[model samples]
Structures are given as C-alpha cells and as structure tokens.
Target chain A: MPNLRVHNLTVSLDGFAAGPRQRLEHPLGEGFEGLHEWMFAAMRDRADGKTGIDVEYVERSEENIGATIMGRNMFGPQRGPWQDESWKGWWGDNPPYHNDVFVHTHHLRPSLAMEGGTTFHFTDEPIETVLGRAYEAAAGKDVRIGGGPATIQQYLRAGLIDELHLAIVPELLGRGERLFDNLGDGIDGYRVAELVGSPAVTHARLVRR
Target chain B: MPNLRVHNLTVSLDGFAAGPRQRLEHPLGEGFEGLHEWMFAAMRDRADGKTGIDVEYVERSEENIGATIMGRNMFGPQRGPWQDESWKGWWGDNPPYHNDVFVHTHHLRPSLAMEGGTTFHFTDEPIETVLGRAYEAAAGKDVRIGGGPATIQQYLRAGLIDELHLAIVPELLGRGERLFDNLGDGIDGYRVAELVGSPAVTHARLVRR
Candidate 1:
C-alpha cells in the first residue's frame, strides 16, 4: 500500500486549519501565511532559493508528494451551483497537485486535464472509491491527505490514513470551521515516530501500530 | 466573555485534525488519545477546567457567546438517512451548549430542549440569518462558529468566526476528512495569543485582526 501521510499542514493555534473567508484572493485567510514559516526555515526551502529557514522548509515539504485528494473549495472558491465548472482551482497555471488528484463532488463529471500533470478526477463513486484510487495512484509512495475537513473526516471514519502532519501557527480566528467537531474516533492505534521542532513549524511523524 | 477555547486540542506531527472512524463513542478517534497526552497533561487540562491560571479567563471567552451554532452531525450521529428524528446527541442528558444552539439541517423540526439550559433550533436558514440570531442572542458577546466542518466552512466563507480553539491529536487516519483542504488562503493576519501545553491537549487562542 502507498504509505499514507500528510507531509506538512499548517494550522492556527486557535484550532483553525485554515483562516476565515476562503476566497480566491484570500486563500489562507487574513493572517495564515505566517503559519508555515517553519517550512520556509527548512534547508529544503533554502535550496530552492527560498530565503530564511521558513521558506526553505515550505519548499521541501511539497517534495515527493505522489498524489493528493482535495475538496472542491481547496481547488477554488466557486460555490452554490458552480456556475458551470469553469473554475479550475485557486492555483493559476499549475496547481500544486501536479501529479493526480481525486476531488469529491456530487456532480458527475469526467476527469479534467490541466496544464501540468495534475488531472482532476471527479468521483461521485464515494469516499472509499476515492481512497482506493488515491492509494493506487500513489503506487506505494506517499499519499497526502489533502483536506478541507470533510474529506479528512471521511478517511478518519474509514481508518485509511496512515500518517499525519500539522504545522501549528501562533494565532486564532476564535471562531471558524474548526478542524474537529463531529469527528469520530481518530485512528485508534498509532505512535509518534518523530518530532522535529522549530519556531514556526513542529514536524512529527506517526507510525501505525 | 466566557472563553470557549480549545484547551485540549491535540495534533499529530502529520497535521490531521483528528483521527478516522469518527463516531459518538470514539469522538477523538482510536489511539488518538495518546497523541494528545500533551493537552491532557495536568497543567493544561486544569487551565480549561473550572479553575487554573486562566480560570477567570475561562468561560469568559463564551461571555460574548450569547448563542451557538452547530450542524446536524454535531447535534447527532444519526447517519445513513434522516429516517426520523429518533436519535438525539451523544452528549447524553446534557450537552455543552447551555445557551441557544442553531442546528443547520434540511429537515424541518422543532427546536429541541436539553439539559443545562441548551435549546436546539433546527433550520435550513442561511448562515447570516442564523448568525444574526446567534449574535442577537450573544448580545455583544462573541458568537461561537460551531462545527461539522461544513458548518464551520459556511461561517468561514462568510468570515463570521472571530476566534477559534483547535486541538491537534498526534495520529493519522490517512484517509479521513480534512478541515482545510479547500480553504483558499487558510488563516492569515492572525496572532497566537496563548499556547498552553499539556499531555492531553494543547490549547491555543487565535485572534483575527
């Protein structure tokens, strides 16, 4: 099986995985850009010409991600009657998920081919189908649990995810979509394999028992 | 204001909000209990409890919270089909919200009465209307943008949430729902007012500018 893992995801200290007003302009909310400062600080980001440790880490975290799964919103802000699916995603020419992506939606559409290797596969086939497809696409590499909360919860309920990652930012929106509200029991058996600390991000790895 | 912050939120190094298999019984998911030991640690849990360093601050966060909002899932785990409003919530006799709770659902039903002075109002009303009612109920107090990720996303898209309290558990369901998959910018222009460490939870406060 492709080792399921979320490389680096940043969250607000207040429990918000993302910021308020998820718009094309304000993708991460008002003050969330700083949450991934740790990623920039990593040596990997620096190697990519990212100044400061923070930029370096951010660059590095995106590496080796074979495949991804995301909700429609993560792709863009098009809502309520998607206005005819013209909205590709928030990403301009090239989306971050350059390889392949499985998007969950009610509308049944065919796979969308983007400029880069990213191909948006709209699956009304249900969560398990998406997961199975994602796992297979990963080809025994690393599969990122790209989120929007609902998608993550589905996997959580099914117990398919293998590893988790969180980059804690020092801020709060006080009230917004919380990461865990109706969440069922999380993965029952797993151990923290590693814990790397920094001013911006605290990276860790979880291993299944 | 009664502060309803996430004092016990735990996150895995991988960035999963909570583990998979979300349910009434395993609210946090399996094995996830261990990942959040930091929050359950003596020091932090006490802080969110009736008394501690931020004792006075406790509940004060919710002071502005005149009314609360929640999704049907947060209201109950009745899945598959609505069938009937036969099932209640997992909270048992009393739920956490002692005030008005606006539950978002398509099913039309009368508001429910619960212990601890909590009332459940079911509505298909738009978030603004619900939030207006909650704000009115809050009467200058902060309104809590409650969840089921969908509910929170609605509020976030509206930019209604002022604060957030999240706990990141140290486990991964590799294939569960995610909180921030589609959040355009996520959180930006925020500050981490506090970072409380513990074994069970790590509570943090996020304030938006």
Candidate 2:
C-alpha cells in the first residue's frame, strides 16, 4: 500500500506551522522564515553540489510523492470565493510539483494544467475521498499531504497520516495557528523512527505504530 | 560569575512544558509523564549503575546550583493567602533540592526549613530582587531557575537566565502551559550550544551570546 505521508513540515518552537496573517506578501507570515532557514540553507548547499542529512531529507521529501493534496490557503491568499481566476499560485511557470496536485477548496473551479506536466484539481470532498482521488492520481505511488497545519491536523486527528517528518525550529513565533491544537492525545501511538540534529533545526521522523 | 541557568526543562513537540489543569494527583498534569519518560528511565538507570546523555543531563541539572528560584505554583497549588501553613511541599520530610530555594509568591509567608538543607523562602519581591537574595544565599555558587514555565518565562523575558538546557520530547500535548508563550522572538539572542538525541528525548542546550 502507498503510504500517506507528511514531510518536512516546519514548525516554530511553539508548534506554529505558519505564522499569523499569512498573505501574498509574507507567505509564511512575519519572521516565520527563521523556522526554515535550515532548509533554505540546505537547498543552497544542494545547488552548490553538497550532500548531507539535511540535504538528503530535503531531497527525500518529494521522493515517492506522485501526487500532493494541499489546502485552499496554500493555493493562495484569496479566500471566501476566488477573486481572480488568473492566479496560478505562488509558483510561477514550471512549478516544482511536476505531478497531479489536488487542492481542497469549497468553490468550484475548472482543472488547471500548468507547465512541466503539472495539473491542479480543486475539490471540496472529505479527506478520505480526497485521499482516494489522490491515490488514483498517484498511480500506486505515495500521496503527499502538503499541509498548512489545519489540513494536516484534520488528517492527524482522523488517524489518516502514516508517517510524519517534522522540522522543529528553535525559535518562538508567540502567536499563530498552532498545529497540535485539539489533537487530544493524537500523537501517543506514534514513535520516533529517526531523529537528526543540526545547528539550524532538529528533524524528527515519527511513524504510527 | 555565578551563572543563572535553567537545566533539563522538558517540553513537548508543541512546546508545552506541562499539560493542562495541574492538580494534586497529577503534578505535571495528565499524561505529561510521557514527556519525561526519558528522565524517569534515566533516574532508574542511575539507581541501577548506568550513565549516558540522559542520565548525564538529569545529573547535571543539579550540578553546581547552590540556590534555586521557583514560582509559587512550583512550590504548591495553594493560592491566595496560604490556606494551610502546615503544607510544607510535595516533597515529604526532605526535598530533593539541597540548598536555599526561593519561592516567588504574591502573598507573604515565613521561611520553612525542611530536612536535607532545603529551605523554602517565600517572597513577593521582583525576579531581580529575589535573584539578589538567592545570590547572597548561594554564596558565589551558581543559581538555578527551577521552573514551572511561568517562572522561567519571567526570567527568560527579563534576560536574566544565562543558559538554558531544554529537553525536547517527541510527544504532543494538545493543551497545556507553554514555556515559550509570550516569548516574542525571545530566543533570538540564544544559540544552540549542544544537541543530543537519544531514543526518548532530544536535549538542546541554549546559551546566550
């Protein structure tokens, strides 16, 4: 069976996956970039032909992800009804995701086919239904939960996520949307499969047992 | 100089040092024991003639501290004018701390001396004033910040804590008292000096530059 996974979901020390007031300008809100400095540096190192645990983890995030399912917020900042249909997401031409990307949204919009063999499919279905759609789109490969915290929280609370790789940054974001809110002992059954530490971040991979 | 330090403070993946609704039965709150499983195991190992990073960290928590400063909540659950004067502490007869421990409280109370060199000095003074008293009592030795989050938060916010050693547990406590709450970019001045990952806990020591 293809595993449903979440990889490299960066969170602040206070467990905020995204800082408050996420908009087009901020993307991850004010000062939240400090949370992903390690990944950004790793990406830079990868561009410079360097390979290590951090680089490997960054690369491995998209290893078997045949399809991705992200929330509407992650698609863009425009909410309560799509204002502009011209919005092709933050990713410009040749988006990083080169496969079927499923977006969870309430409004109905036609499927969008972008460059580099990527396509965006919007749906308002339940998580399981979306997972089913994602599996079919994945074609036997793994399904990636591209989270904005609320989406991942739903999957976690429903015991749908199989693996989670969290990058915990050692900075406090004070006030923001907390990822672990209302989890209610949801992380009890999971065990730490692996843990790696760097000067910038601590990577923890948890597997549901 | 006697460095003011916080050592072996355990926080969940969600950054909560203690769970919600602390009561007499559950000191660390319900299910919070999972956060300190590594510490509990380390204590057992210490009794069984074992030594490692976990044990070392636990042992080092009390290494050179001659005095401790804690909040009234850490002392007990008593609130508003100390209903029971006979209530010494959770530690019966002799407490683990073998030095002068200052308890921060709004209400005034007399100093109570327990066995094994542990004396609870109740004071409503400011953190700096209390630290001064603790320094005098410590007699050139290091002063420890024995935390219940709020106390440490105060010291941390005031830039009084020189060093902080935090144990990041792999579990998620949905609701509780967070250690990093109201610490807006409070950890920016500190850097991770050391990080060690064991099976149950990942220890990160932060030092202010």
Candidate 3:
C-alpha cells in the first residue's frame, strides 16, 4: 500500500503552522507569508535548475501524491454554514493539486470538478471513512494530507499519518494556529529519520515506528 | 565591552523554553527533562571524552561568560514572599555557575556566597540597573543571561541581548512558558547566523543585526 504522508508543512519556530484570523484578504493569515518565504526561494532555485536538499524535498512532495485531504478552512475562509455555492477554492483556475481532493466540511456540497483534472468532494463523514474513500480514489498511489494545521492535528491525533516532513522556519509568529496542540499521546512514537539545515529553514523527516 | 548573551537554552519543538508548573522536585518543570535529554547526552559524551558539535556548543557557553542574570523563577520556586531564609537555590553547595549571579526579584534577600566562586545577589531593580551591576561585576568578560523564559523575554523586549543560542529539541511540550510571547517587536531584526543538527537537537545561533 502507498504510504499516507504529510510533506513540506512549514511551521514557525514557536510551532504555529498558520497565523490566526485567516480570511479572504489574508489567505494564510497575517505575517504568515514570511513562513513560506523560504519555500518560495526554493521554488525559484528549482525554476532556475538548481537542485539541492530543499529542492529535492519540494520535488519529493509531488512524487506519488494521487489524492489529497484538507480541512474546510484550507478550502476557503467561510465559517459556519456555506452561504454561496459560487465560492470555490483559494487557488485560481488550476490548483496545485491535480488529483482528487477530499475536503472535510460539516455542510455538504456536490463534487466540484475543476480544470486540470482536480475534483473537490466535501464530506462530514468520520476521518476513517474519508480516508477509505480517498485511498480508493487514489488507487495504488500515495495520499497526501494537505493542511492548515487543524486538519493535520486531527490526522495526527488519529495516528493515521505514516510519515511527516516538517520545515521549522526561523521566524516566530507568536500568535497563530499551533500545529502541536491538543495532541495527547499522538506524537510519542515518531523519530526524526533525517535532518537537514539550510539558510531558510530546518527540515526534519519524522517516521512513525 | 562585555556582550550580553544567552547560550545553550533548550526549547521544545513549539518554542517553549520551559514546561508548565515548575517546582522543587521538577526543577525544569514536568516533562521538560526531554528537552534537555540532548544536553545530558552531550554531557555523557563529554564525560566519555567524545568531542563533537554538541560538546563544542556546551564548551562555547562557558568560554567568555563572567557574570550571569536570571529571573526569580530560575532562582527558586518560592513566590510572593520568602519566608525561609535557607532557600539558597535549586543547585547545591557548589552551583555550576562559578561567578557573580544577579537574580531579579521583588522581595529583597541578602547575598549568598556558595562553596565555589558563585555568589547570588538579589535585586528589585529594573533590568537595565541589574545589567549595569552585572557588567560592572564582569569587569571585562561577557555577561550571560541565564533564563527561565520570562527573564529572557524581558531582555529581548529591551533589546539588550546581543546574541542567542537556541537549541530546538525533538520533543513537543504542548503547554509551557513560551519564550517568544508578548515581546511585540522584540524578535525582529535578528537572523540565524549558524545552524547545527545532531541526533539529539538542532542548534541555531541568532545574532542581532
């Protein structure tokens, strides 16, 4: 079976995965752009044909990702009930994920078929059930847990992730959605399989035993 | 001039310098031992005559320091008022610090000279005033900012810290006295000059620009 993985999830030095008060105007929340500035620089290097540890890690994120699972907050900034059906994802035209994407939401909506072979399926079902559907959709390929911290926390709490690539950014967000909160005994069994230090971020690969 | 510096302070993956509910039995607080496991291991290696990055960092912390400044919390767990005059410190007769140590406290206490060259001087003065004394006491050597998170936060807020050597441990302390809280703009204008990754921890040197 393909491994369930979380790749290239960058967090602040204070462990904030994303800043607080996430809205339409500020997609990743205020002062959060600094968190991903390193990733952007890595992307630039890759575009210029420079391949190193960071570029290799970035390239590995897309290796076998056939399907993805994300929280509703990552899909959009809308809270409570979904008022308008016209609202799509934050990504314009073509999203980065080119495969089937399962979004966890209380309010159900029909499957959204977007351009570039990406489809959005909203669900209120249990995480296990959603995982089963996503695994079936993936069909022998790996499933990616794309997150905004809360969704990743649920998966981590459930002990469903096989491996995680966490990039520890040097900046301190101070206030934001911390990635390691409310996780009881969920993070006890992981070990850092590999570690790499770069100018932008400190990257560690956590493997579950 | 002697530089004001913080060295070899271990923190969790979440940027917590020390864990919650610090007391006599649990000096570093509950579950905080994991954060310093690397330091202990490094000490062990040093005892075994092994020299590496961890040992180098530990040795560097003691290289240039003369006097030290710490918060009341680091001095002891006694809060509000000091009833017992016998409470010298968590460290026994011969404390690790073999120099003048100025402790910031609201309550007044007489200076205690330990078995070693260590001497504890209690003060109710502002951080600047205490630093002035520490610098004077140092004569020429660098003054170290020994911390319990709150003390470091204050010095950071005042922009008195010239450099910081932070060790990012592998474990997560979900809740604790966060080192990066309530400083407003204190953490800005600093850059990570060097990074070292080992089995136990990832150490980063932050220099103010």
Candidate 4:
C-alpha cells in the first residue's frame, strides 16, 4: 500500500511547527526564518549536499510523492473567506509540487490549474474523504502531507499518517503553532523508527506501529 | 560567579518534560517511563558506555556540580504542607546528590541532612534568592538545576540558567508538563550550541547568548 507520509516538517525545540501569527508578510510567522536554515543551507550547497544527512533528508521529502495535501494556510497567507481568487499561492506559476494538490479549507474555491502539472482543489470535506481523493490522485504513489501544523495535526489525530519525518531545529519559538499538541491516543500508535542528527538539526522519523 | 546549568533534562518529541498526573508510583508521570530509556541504557552498559554519545552526555551531567536546586516535585511526591515529613525523597539514604540541595517550596520545613554529603534545605524564597543560596553552597562550582519541568521553567523564565542540555527522546507523551511552555521571550536569550544524536535519543545543548 502507498504510504501517507509527512516529511521535512521542521519544528522548534519547543515543538512549534511554525512561529505564531503567520501573515502575508511573514508566511511562517515571526522569528521562524531561521527554522528552515538547514534546508536552505543544504539547497545552497547542492553539489556537495548529497554528502550531508541534512540535505539527504531535504531531498528525500520530495521523492515518490505523486499527490500532496495541505492546509489553506500553507496554500497562501489568506485566512477566513478569500478576499479574491487572484492569489496564486506563494509559489510562482510552477510550484515545486507537480501533481494534484488538495487544500483543506472551510471556504470552497474552484479547482485551479497552475503552470506545470500542479492543480489545487479546495475542499471543506472530512479528512478521510480528502485523503481518499489524494490517494486516488496519487495513482499508487505515496501521498505527501504538506503541513502548516494544523493540517498535519488533523491527519495525525486521525491516525492517517503512515510515517512522520520531523527535523527538530534546536531553537525556541516560545509561542507558536505546536505540532504535537492534543494528540490524545492518536500518538500511541506510532514509534520512533529512525533518529539521526546533522550539525544543523536532528531528524526523527516516526512510523506507525 | 557559579554558572547555573541544567543537564540530562529529557523531554519527549512533543517537548513534554514529564507526563501528566505525576505521583509516587509514576515519578516521571504516566507514559513517561520510556523518556529516560537512553539514560538507563547508557548506565546499564557502564563499562563500554563511554564510547557512545548518550553515555557521554549522561556522565557529563554528573560532572562539575557542587550543589543542586530542585522544585518540591523533584524532591518528593508529597504535595501541600508535606504530610508529616516522613518522605525524605525518592532516593533513600545516600542520595545521588552528595551536596547541598535546595528545594523550592511554598511550605517551609527544617533542613534535613541525609547520608553522604547530601542535605535538603526547604525554602520558600524567590527564585533569585534561592539561586543565590545555591551559588553560595556550590562554593565556586557550577550549580545544577534539577527539574520537574516547573522548576526549570521558573529558572528559564528568569534567564537564571546558563546552560541547558536536553535529551530529546523519540516518543510522545500525549499530555504532560511541558518544559518550554509559557517561557515568553525568555527563550530568545538561548541558542543551540551543540546537537548530537544516539540511536536512543538526541542531545541538544543550549547556551545563553
């Protein structure tokens, strides 16, 4: 069976997946620019990046992902009702994801076809329904859960995630959207399968037990 | 000045220092037994443990400490007025801390000197005042902050802690006392000095900037 994997989900030492008060100006919220420094550094040194574990994990997040599911917050900085449909997302015409992308939101929007193969379908349906659509769109390939914390938490709480790869950045956001809150019994079904560290961050992979 | 350092403070992937509903039977709190597995494993293989990073960190926590300061919770499982002072602490007779130990509490009690050089002094003084006493007792050696999450949070909020070494365990304690909660801007003063991982856990050293 194809896996429902969450990868390269960076969180602070305090467990904040994203800094608080995410806005149009600061998409990841304030004091979180440094959170993805490891990934940026790895991408910068692309030639020698493969030699480093940090880069390897960053690259691994994109592998074998046929479809992606993300929250509307991740889709754009827009909140509540959409101001306009003009916002084409943070990524330009050709987003990194070249497959069908499902955006979880309360406000419905028509399907958007972007440059390349990426298409955005907004839905307010239950997580299971969206996941089913994502899997169908994936066509036997693994489904990637692109997160903004809330979206990932939804999947995690539902125990739908097959694997979770977290890059724990050694920084304290103090106040932010925490990745591992209110998990209840949903977390009991998983165990840490792999743990490794690079100079920049510690990578922990949790698999469903 | 004697530096205030925190060592071997193990937290779950969700950043919980201790699980919820701590009591005598569940010292580290419920579902938190696995949090300290790395430390226990490292200690079990004492002869050859020095080669591993986990063991090295475990040993490092014990070195260069003159006095220890902990909250009431770390000292005993008793709550509110001590209940006759029959409890000397979890560690009987010759306790692990063989030095002047200060226990921060609301209810005052007479100082109790135990086996080995360990002496427990209960004080209702402020954090700064207690820290001053701890520093004086240290006699120029570093003072270790023995935590129960709340204790560490107090020290952290005041920026009194000089160094914090956290063992990031790869597990989830759904509900518990979070170490990094309500820190406000207190977390900004610290930066990750070193990060290393073993098979069991990842150790992160944060030093005041």
Worst 10 residues of 4 chain B by lDDT: B45-54
Question: Clashing residue pairs, candidate 3?
Answer: none
Question: Which one wins on lDDT?
Answer: 4
Provide the lowest-lDDT 10-residue window in model 1 chain A. Answer: A195-204
lDDT of 2 at A195: 69
lDDT of 2 by residue, B58-104 (tens): 89887888999998888887768977698888889899998999999
lDDT of 3 by residue, B1-209 (tens): 68999988998765678877898877778879767777788889989999988998888888878899999899998888999889989889999999999999999889999988999999999999999999999989999998978999889888889988989887666667877787767777566677777766888887785
lDDT of 2 by residue, A121-172 (tens): 9999998999999999999999998888889888887788899898877665
Worst 10 residues of 3 chain B by lDDT: B187-196
lDDT values, one for every candidate: 0.62, 0.84, 0.86, 0.88
lDDT for each residue of candidate 3 in A1-209, tens digit (9 for 90 to 100):
78889988998776788987899987788879767877888899999999887898899988988899999999999998979888889898788899999999998999999989899999999999999999989998999999979888888878888889989887767678877776777776565577677756888887785
Q: Any runs in candidate 1 off by more than 4 Å, and if so which?
A: A29-34, A37-45, A48-60, A190-195, B1-209
Q: How would the candidate models be sorted by lDDT, starting from the highest?
A: 4, 3, 2, 1
What docking grade applies to model 3? acceptable
TM agreement with the true structure for every prediction = 0.51, 0.87, 0.87, 0.96
What CAPRI grade goes to candidate 4? medium
lDDT of 4: 0.88
Q: What's the lDDT for residue B115 in model 4?
A: 97
Best by TM-score: 4
**Which pairs of residues clash in candidate 2, taking residues 3 or more apart in a chain or in different chains?**
none
Q: Give lDDT: candidate 3, residue B144.
A: 97
Q: How do the residues A67-179 of candidate 1 rate in per-residue lDDT, one tens digit apiece?
A: 78887766667655566867777676677678789887776567888887898888677777777788788776676777776676677556677766655666555545555
**In candidate 4, what are the lDDT values of residues A1-209, reduced to their tens digit?**
99999998999887889887899888998888878888889887766536688878878888899999999999999888988899988999999899999999999989999999999999999999999999999999999998989899889988999999999887877788888886778988888888888888899998988
